[model samples]
Target: MGKKAAMQKSKQWNVKGAMRLTSVFHFLQSCGSGCLVPFLTLYFRHLGLTATMTGIIMASKHLLTLVWRPVSSILARQYDKRRTVIVGSLLSSALVVLILLLFPSAGTKAESGRCNASQPSADFTDGSDFTTLESMIIPSQSNVTVYSVNHTTVIMEQPDDLNSTYTPTLVNSSSNWSRRAIRYLRELKEQQEESLHTEFLGSLKAMDAQHQMFFLVLIVIGLWEFMAAPLEWTADDGLYEYLDFVDATDRHKGVTVWKPLGTAVGNGVVGILVTSLYCRTGTVAEFYSYTAFMILTVPTAALLPLYIRKRDRPTSGGFKALQLVHRNSQALLCAITVVLTGIASSAVSDFLLWHMQDHNATEIHMGISLALAHLSQAGFPLYAGHLAGFLKYHGWLLVLAVIALSIQCLYYSFLWDPWSIIPAQILAGFSTGALWWSVAAQCEDIATPGTEETLIRLFEGLPLELGSGLGSLMAGFVMQKFGIKILFQGISVILAVWSITLAALKWKIPRQRRINYSRLLTADTGEISESESDQEKDWLETAMEDDNQKNNWTIAKS
Candidate 1:
């Protein structure tokens, strides 16, 4: 998630102010996102949302990406409104957090699963107290008697408080003692029955209250996500636009590194604050910190680039991208890989916290866990190009991602304590970034000359979102029905099978290396030039053919 991805690096921006402002912008974005995103499931649990409900809410982030990203991109391109979109999104999203904090239904309430014993009512008259021989059977429940004495039973329930006193019916000279006992027993029965009814009604009301807040949060958070969606790609698009304008496109990593750095720092700091301040579930600290960081992001948002990159020709359409994937085997593999990877990653992101929480994990631990994942994920892609270029590790990346995710699933399947889980969190971004790298590299290598843009759109866009949304839904039900351990174990098995299948595919249909094997092997700086990689592919192929021919000749002579 921390990875700004395989998009081209922007040229360096020489202006000091622009660089400073963009750095600050990236920092705040990461800080705000990292501080609270990992703990959101815990927040929902504190608010009494069911596991399935939380899944739907988390899944909305991905599914809704389908709707908002294009809208943001179109507006940014057609109207040159990147600044407007990012600022508006931050403010609107901040407002949504504020609303959730203030909304009463969103606050903590009595759990419906709690057990509350109803009080017992009893009364004894003081006037003319001569009645005696009033034998009582076992205390009655719901007006049913366990024993009777002389065709009458005077059963009295004890109060919950042990200090409360009960008056015994003494011997009576009055003939109406039986009538009095009967009357008093009837009153006690009626009172107990009334109390039971009241409790039943109260429970129903509490359940209604739980459901009311659940739906309210669902709608509000969905809207919040919809508003916030543009902040991801739209803001970067603007920054890259400015970089293109100033011929600083190569400085993309320099400007974008702030997001992951800030996010990592924010997570660690906020987690500590939550721990020290006792900002437990249903608390205000997480939301407050998020709102503050987002508010800080506003000033930086003002200076970001908003100009659209002017294209002289029309790019390939979305439909054309699908047509390419349909015809190309590697492209088809990329699409499937992204989708399945999205599903596994989504399930882990959405519900693994719930699993940790079950083992007594707190916000701080989750924060650090997420911080580690972000740092690890962010670092990989820096060298991913070299690895893919030098060894042509595209197919192997898929294998690594699948196996990494499978290992993660297995680790989580045996999750005992939350602290031990942090180490496993490192795999979180590795698995995702590996798959993204593999798919992106494959799409780039296999695309038709003019259809590169469309091909990129196909693998990165809808398939990931659709898979994420679907995974969340299915995992949610599995978690609620069986348990977290079983759910992850099942996912691990499925991934194991998929990994084997992919291994077989890689064996059967090997992809040609896109980079020159000899040059990268010899470069001292260890820097990979993609341009060089592209130019020398034909040369590498010719050498391979010549070697193969020589091997055949040698074998024939021998």
Candidate 2:
């Protein structure tokens, strides 16, 4: 009795601790994301890369993330989720620090000084005697040859002390011919200086060997990012898993309310900190500080699982259940929606900094914009979740997402000032926050028992990986070709078409007929017992007999 009571008390302690730990973990993770991710495009631009190149780099990371999704899922299952999160967070942080150390800043103090001192001198003199001026100017109309005896090409200046009788014999030897020639020489020298400056500036703008090194470092960073992709989804999945041990009401409260609330607070705090740091020191210094914070938080995040009991760890099924998830239609459709949502979100979040910066937004404005968006994100999930419950069809929640996205696109289309962009994020926040909560809950609803983590990861990671990857690439190309406004318009159109199609499909099929969880188990698992099979057959036969009886009754009445 003593041992049993101790075990029960331990379980109670774990339950309470797990809830708080999940919230704290999400908060820290989001803090890091808010500080670094939104500014990445601008960071690349700071490093002298073009929009297309920045997109390519971001796309590469997402592509690697897609490749890593399955691997991360397996790793999470094979080990503790806490272990996976810890290692991934630490490695990602280390890579960020390494990248900063490996690559020098794009514009260094010495290089700036060199660029300044390399300016062409205004006085065009070679400190040579002008007695041979007549020898330098050809008499023929073919060409004027200015020879330099010491290999120093002197500018041809007409001597003001030249005797009026000593007119030089030259082509078109008018009285003012020497003056015209001197004027032409000065113009040529000025042109050369301008060309030199232009070349120097172009060199600064163009990608070179150092830029290639930066690109290579980014690829390495992507590899590190691949490891971190599963952390967010894992937290959500783990929380849902914890719900199995707690009251059902906590599921709604924990997921919709607490999780987003924590994320909002973290994002808001980080936004303020980022704004302050960026205003004082600039982006590079701010990035370094953020990375340091991320590194320190990894250990804090790792402490979560220590408080979680073994019974609270997420259950995993073998590879067979993993295969079963793919055949589940509800899961498939949910995954597709998530993918589309990811594409839309990535296009905006990844490039919002660049978009606002184009409109002359200061760092403080950018931080406030992101903070406000996250705050909206924090507040809306519970309401959106409640609204989803109020509506008969959960699928309509997606339609709401589509509407929110459309509003954001419409608002951004007309926004000419940076601060004006902040208000648009209200829609963005609702769209993204709603989609995230809805997709997770929907995936949980459809997940096979013991395969919850696997399905959640698939639903969360795969769609986001592919959508964000493709979206970043597309956004880069579109923005480069047309502009930011056109890109948002195009995204809006695609989303409109997609949402219409989804709505039509949803309308055609009643929600009750959409997914039969028992059917998923029987069709996928092949593990039904004899009694369960017998019960299924009896139920089917009874339904058929009832249909026949009703037909017979109708005939008799007629």
RMSD of each: 12.2, 12.2
| lDDT tens digits, residue span 1-558, model 2 | 999999988865476667666566666566666656667677666665666777788888888777765566546645666566665755575465446445545532121222233433312223643233433343211123343333333333345454633322434333365467656755654555456556754333343434654566576667657656666545554456456555442442553454444444444555566556653445664466456556766765666543234643433443544555464555456667778877877888767777787776666677677777777877775477578878765667877777688678767767788779877877666687777666666656545555655555566566778998888888888888998889888888888887788778777643323234455554643543223334345445667899999999999999
What lDDT does each candidate get? 0.69, 0.62
Model 1 misplacement above 4 A: 1-20, 103-207, 245-250, 253-256, 279-282, 309-324, 382-392, 447-458, 510-558
TM-scores vs. true structure, each candidate: 0.70, 0.68
Q: 467-495 in candidate 1: lDDT tens per residue? A: 88888888888889998888888888988
lDDT of 1: 0.69
Give the poorly placed runs of model 2, Cα more than 4 Å off. 1-13, 76-88, 91-95, 101-210, 233-267, 274-280, 306-331, 510-558
lDDT of 1 at 481: 95
Question: Native-vs-model 2 lDDT?
Answer: 0.62
